[model samples]
Target: MSSSDGTAADASWERSDGRSRPPPTVNTIRRIRQACTNCRHRKTRCSGERPRCMNCRRVDRVCHYEPYSTTNPPSSASVAANNGAAKGKSPSSLFPRAGVVDISRLPLATRKSRQSSPSHRLLSINIRLPPPSPQTPFPTCQVQCMRFTTAPPPAVMDHLIDAYFLHVHNQPYSYFHEQSFRERVNYGLIPKCLLFAILASALKFSDIEYFQGSIREATEAYAREAWLAILHEHLTVENNPTLAERTLTLLTLFYIGGRTSSGWLKIGLAVRIAQDLQLMREPKNTMPPIEQEEHRRAFWSIYLLDKLVSVGQSRPPAIAEEDIHVQLPSDEETLRRGIWKKTPTLHQLINWKSETESSVNGTFTQTILAATALGRCCRYVLHGREMDEMPPWDPRSDFTLLNTFLLLIDHHLQVETPSIPQIVEHYRRPDGTLDFQSLEHVVFARIVFHTAHCLLNHPFLLRMRLQKSNCKVPPKFLTRSFQISCNHARSISSLVEDAIASGCHVQSSFYAYASILAGGILSLAIHIDQEKGQVTDPETLNHYQKAIHILERTGRRWDHASKMVSLHCLFRAIL
Candidate 1:
């Protein structure tokens, strides 16, 4: 301003003087046109330059100038519109915002995003399909939307499904029915939660390590999605009992992948749902053959799980023996072929003998029967001890009840004993190592049976110890019980070592529990022998060390195994 005014005044004075004024002395100075966004927001001066100015470069800030325009700058919306125009599309069409779908255009239950990756995509694809009208056999629109949103490529889905059936479903205690599950997946009739659970389980069992790292993340994401879907759809067992039960069962497995406590919680929910569906009762003969068989299988599966979980967690069984009227499950082949056959109850099977084979022959039917007996024995022992320890207890009455239970367990063991030699012969190879893959279920069953025997006789052995300590001669029956308990404990340890040598210990969940049980008994025996000034057997000490090693290896995969290992170490130190 000073230069311009001074030059104008000098020019005006020269003109007034009517003389040709020499060019007014002028000074050239460059003015800044604009500042960068950072400088302008900070109210700092900036030299306008092509890339960066000295002021911005000195302070390590980016410098930029607004475009020179005679007209006003365009708004965000206008800029977006120009972008859309350049791409030959409307702005609204280019940017598809969530929650913009018209609710009135679809059924209330079908109001979910069809886009593959929604903000809540990992929550669950739990959108409920509207009930089909008499005019329509299926809710086509809902099914279509579900497929579009949650279903993976057919090839990938097929591989995962096959993997699950091969690795998980084929296990003796698994609950899923292959034919029905396959149909549901093929037709997109499965719930999103179940689908994700299946995928998570399959991925977990995949041998590829790269995929295993992803498995945990994918499982968590799918689990969250499934839960969100449940909430959004307001799913209840009353409205959809079948889906609810299936989802709960799959969720139990999902929890078993990492969180043992949560797995138990899901198993509890599954039990309640099974009861709600009247799965405790045998199916009526009037129902379709497939439905009848499926009902029977489902009930028995839940029963097996109830017993397994009870024994595994050292808790009482949820499905009472008296409450179940459903028959035992048939062999896998018969079930797979959809052949329905009436089977005897577990109690009847306990007394029933096969003339062709005196003991359980490692068949699925026989294994489950043995498991049922073992479960009952475990419960009786656990409950009997509780009763004996209760305030105002009658020692004579409790002892009588305990003895009666022991006699019953003894009879059950006698019936199951002959199968042991037969199983060992069947699975042993020429080289003398057990065929682990083929015999894992059989070995696990044997371990459970023997462990139950040990548990049943341990208390009697303790009584004998007390009697001996008091210088009173123990009864012949008490001495026999002690010897039998030691034999069973030794057998358990032998089986664990065999399984480990076969490289199949990790394949079964029972391995860790069986190892801990056997090790604890051996440790107790060693402690007792030491207190009596008797030399501890070298073989027994070796078995205890082997048990510790097995638990250490198992701990790498299961948190429960690690805890058991710690407890075993502490107990050993104390002894």
Candidate 2:
């Protein structure tokens, strides 16, 4: 029988019956080697890396390097754990029971484990935010759980994106030196996204007065065309089909001025490019032109276009009663005034339609006619045209128009996934880190600015209605008016303050826009007071203070003289 410590009187353990045990062998030592290192120790043949040995590696632990004698006999437990192979298994044995790993067989998995370092992980996490990383911000198929609720503000995210774009393009914002810019261009850095942002912003918000007053005087059609040509030339030079596809998607959301058929055609062009580049589809050996790939683009285009158009119709500008002259059309001249007219009273045009069936070039005659009619109306309002007669335009109910526009905007937001909030949180680490703090500031500024600007300063709508005199008024109308005015003022002020605090550089054009928006909101608040007999509520006072703070901060950076004028008007009207 074996001794109580389970060792025999030999180098290898033996049974109590007195047979000689084998010597401790290389196989046993090698098993111990792996077990030790895994446990980060030297070779020992014990079961616990706690006591690390050959037994330890098999049991998944380090082999302990204690002073246990190399001459000590193997225990029954150790031999049993090794399935009796420890005593006799050959060094060349492919199937050793001692848990020795084959280094050669593990080459691929080990290489992969080595390649996936921490930096790669961080980059993978960064790109999922709706704005994407600046270098390659396109969304991947990877889905990850995120920590935050809501998205990073768009203005802030845009800055981060811009930084990334600059880095990728290797274009330094530091120097406007033409040679440096050209060098970066040669290195494949074209500011496609930056240019796109500028154009889109101009298209969407450029007032006719601003266009006529400034741009028309400075730049001709040839200059604009040349700029576009440069962009096109770079897109060709880059041969970057993916970038082209992304550009198409952006244009679809922001521009691409047709509905239905034309939209489908444009989308078809995107899909064809995508196919050629294998971006959205498996490329066949051959490719087809836009006309041939009609089916691919038609479905998404029709669906997205209809969705966008409906949304556009919903956000019809809110008109007020006092802005329009109460009169009927007498002739074409009078009709022109009627076309420019705002609703003299809120419900007077409630039965009028915003859209009507008409013919354009083989496309959305209704949308084109509606846009043209609306544009004409807004022009008349801006020009202070004679308000003698109603126009020849068909009556479109205000409800129809407002609902359609809202729906279109909603659809675009959903499809585009721009500035999606939740995706941004995924980029943070476990302790909740964030990059591009400036992005947050810029985004918040833009949002607040747009909200206030669109509500207060849109040429077609009267968001604020100033009474000629604040004398007798119905209580309900007054209360409703106050509620709208107070809430909007508070919201605008709060957003502006938050934006400024985010450390958005006050000198940015975006910051200037925010200042302008604040000024307009303040003007609206003052107008509300004028309508209420020069009486300012506590909420109004609070909003005024907030607006003052924004002006003080932002004015230090931008020469917002027009904004100051608006602020002055606000004080005069209210006080």
Candidate 3:
């Protein structure tokens, strides 16, 4: 067997038979293990990147280091002295005196010595070869080489991280059209794997205390590659997961407005990646829960509806025009006669070869929901209007379930804290409070937020006015009570009257909760006065002013009443 100290690490000796024997493990190989100067310079956790590192290419960098293994064996005393160090010393210190034991120091032993000590025959050590140096195509593997132990270079690390984020931003997800576009959609422009790699790289590169923790959580949530492998594997086909992950990231970014461009790009990428996944023929099911939902929703909302609408299957006869005095059909009748009543032709177009539950029906339902939301969004965007004038959209009630969800959400948000428990409990019990996140809470939250966003076009001042003719009690009681029991019918009626009369220009949307609140306050004032038997106008005015100030300070505006309807008139001068 050849000695390991003075020859290239790959060199081997021929055995008596046909096979070649590995070079002997030398003092230097034991001392350095696989650690090399280049790896230390780059601070890369090397997988011993073969030919070159899969990780380095992801970041657009060159991998370089000196290969320092040879065939010569060091003396027994030298080996013993080096190994005698505390077990805690690193495995790469088999030569005690040399910081990095050079292969040149130990030359191969003679054939006589190999024969004399057959048990001591050298065995080859496995160490990664470094990439080529500038002067040579092959890496420098001199018998004598310098070594140091430290992290990788900062510039190299920066380059790697930057590459990772770029890759992620470029991941592809395309909109569905014809089957012919499948290849372009799936593999076109950017791929999903690149997007994952970017996120993983960002988390790895960030110096924040929670970066690692976030990566771990994301890895579990996104069902993507591990953080390291993002850079480690780059954009290879095996690494790409799904578009849902990209969509989820995009949605969060849209909501939060953090890293704006990066977030939006992720959405586009998700669309492309999703199309890629759709075209895949293999049976696979390792998607994360969030992704599964996004995938289902995206397909239904984006593609299936177009197909249905194209074939006239979803069309409804136009409703006859009538005067304002004519009571239009109830919201339920309108929806049933107009949209939901018709069956659609979407089923045929979406029947893929796989004999599984048809995605078409689910897509159809989702598309309808999406269309409704889109209508609301467009209405507000164009007309600058609110849904307060329209009937609620409860699917279970006269309205669609989606509309009811919006109403509940509006009611909840109008209150001080929009807890899911409190909103759910409002329908269940007026006095009870609930805690904890529930499925009902999440579903409603989704429905309400999406619909409200669709409906609300512009921001406007929200004001409340308590009527003097109806108030005999303290106003504080009314504000507190009405804010709590937001749905009490009588209170809502009173507030609506106040909002209509209030001269302050306001968006009609604010009237819903604000009107109810004003009525509750008026009732409270009336009750207080009745309890006292009689209250002077000045005293009533003082209470109204105090309560109004409280509301204003708390971010609740109530300036809508006519200027003549002053604080003094609020309690009707019941001194």
Give per-model TM-scores.
0.61, 0.30, 0.28
TM-score of 3: 0.28
- Residue 527 in model 1: lDDT: 85
Model 1, span 26-48: residue lDDT tens? 68455566655435433556666
Candidate 2 C-alpha lDDT tens digits along 376-426: 333333333343232212136332344344334233223123332432343
Error of 1 at 43 (Å): 47
Q: Candidate 1 or 3, higher TM-score? A: 1
lDDT, each prediction: 0.58, 0.35, 0.32
- Which residue runs does candidate 3 get wrong by more than 4 Å? 1-256, 279-419, 422-575
